[model samples]
Target: MGGVSETHQMAPRPRRRRRPYRLAAALLVLLGLAGYYLVQNESTGGDGAPHCTVVAGGDAGGSYSMNLEQARYAATIAAVGTARKMPERAVTIAMATAMQESALRNLDHGDRDSLGLFQQRPSQGWGTPAQIMDPVYSAGIFYDRLKEDVPDYADLPLTVAAQKVQRSGFPDAYAKHEPDAALLAAAFTGRAPGALSCSGPLPQDTGDATRVKAELVKVFGSALAPKAGPPASRVAAQQAPADDSEVTLSVSGKDYQGPADQRRGWELANWTVAHAAELGVQRVSYGSKAWIAGKNKGRWIDKAPGKSGDGDPRNAGPDDVRIFVAPLNR
Candidate 1:
């Protein structure tokens, strides 16, 4: 028998050996791209929208930040608490709840038909989707429930108090946001002057006295009259600014009294601060303290003893909260 020719065919070498190198290179490219975007976002605030900072007690007590929309909602929440005469603690609880519920963004949707900043459920008697979507109305409802259901909420632990009003599946999640909420409350409630500020280019809208009055009515449910003017004068003042480059709104002390009055003043002042970007507010003065947008790096600075209201050399009295609005670009 001829030598049996048995040839063994070798299996083709697998191509798997090169795949790891290619994958590693691709991962490096992805990582580089991610890092580049992160840096860019940090530097320019991503989309160029204005940014707000809530500092706790003059930058020593830590801080938290959110975009313009979140800041606006937070201000509304605080304003509602003030309007309801709820204590700062109540505002803190509401803010913390909103922070956990929707990250302070008024949502048009939520878990199982829940909606708005508080994630209140329409199916559970919260409100119609339209009403719940209104920040002012929603905030009012939250305060009403908090007051009606948890009367002693101010004295209770934040989580416990919030859980009572929310009845959330993750009841304990609220606790994690207390620190941030407290900081925001301090600024929004006017417990901490100059505690909040917004930076970057102002919004495109140039706010005027009329817009200021309108916004005040929208949030506090009443028009804010000038301290020195009659109703007719107030109306005339709201018509248009003499300079057209600037406008001012004054809060009168006649309507408020005692410590609660002071709280309300701060609330209005802080509300102005919160809306500074949107309203084109250049400066806000209450008592002797003033917060100038983009001044001293957007911190509250002391106004001279006799200088307030656009450097008029007259005191902005304790009973008055004066807001000066200027062109955003200016």
Candidate 2:
């Protein structure tokens, strides 16, 4: 006992165990890397916008795949174009309808002669087979009514507002499509409309901005120009068509269209013009009311109409827009 006390055993210097700091740090780094990879590959199954192909038979009376393909393209164009034209809310609703009506696929066949992306019935005054087949026109027509009926559509329920325009037999059908449409809208609008596309096969073909714009001109008219720098040549609209007009546009899709039909006509016209460069449009006409006669005669004007609301005489009807275009110089 006395010896032990004297020895005062240096208390087994508690086997000083080294801290595992480096190991811990390494593990944390590995976890962080794994998380990042998981998120990035979340949507694409590790292959973004994969080139998956499906057989969609024909525009109508074709394979289910073919029918769906049409709708997908229609949805893509509408979502992207509307995002460019109106607000996100409108795009959301439009996408929702396409999702339900055709699974975001343009089906030439629908209940009792209905056709096109919206399943619009030619017999009911939508348009002809060819016209309805044109996605841009169909979308434009849908937008016309949408802007008219949807007072504050951006905030309205997607299904509710869409039903107002579509008057579908089954109003509730649109509800089920909200999820998928949201996804497509997000991807097309560049807002992450959805975390991913449908689990099914991805469309092998998707049009580009240039292609879409060209189709826009084909379906609508040569009333739009691409968003390019100054035009290589421009012909004074006044000097051309007697009915030719002018319109001042803004980023908000606000503009002056003059009279009743004039407003609608011009709105569409201006939209075409705005999309001219993108659509490879060569010439266009904005109603005379839109022309300042002096101020930046050819330059775009945004302050004239639709700025103050219904009071502005130049403002077009909620559904009216009559505008057209020609080659820049011709």
Deviation in angstroms for 160 in model 2?
Answer: 1.0
lDDT of 2: 0.47
User: Residue-wise lDDT of candidate 1 within 107-162, one digit each (tens)?
Assistant: 98889999999999898898999999999999999999999999888789999999
Q: Write the per-residue lDDT of candidate 2 for residues 28-123, one digit (tens) a residue.
A: 999998886665344223532212212222342211211324434633454345434666567668777876786555677989988877888888
Runs of candidate 2 with Cα error greater than 4 angstroms are 1-75, 193-213, 216-330
Clash pairs for candidate 1: none
Q: TM-score winner among the candidates?
A: 1
TM-score of candidate 1 to 2 decimals:
0.73
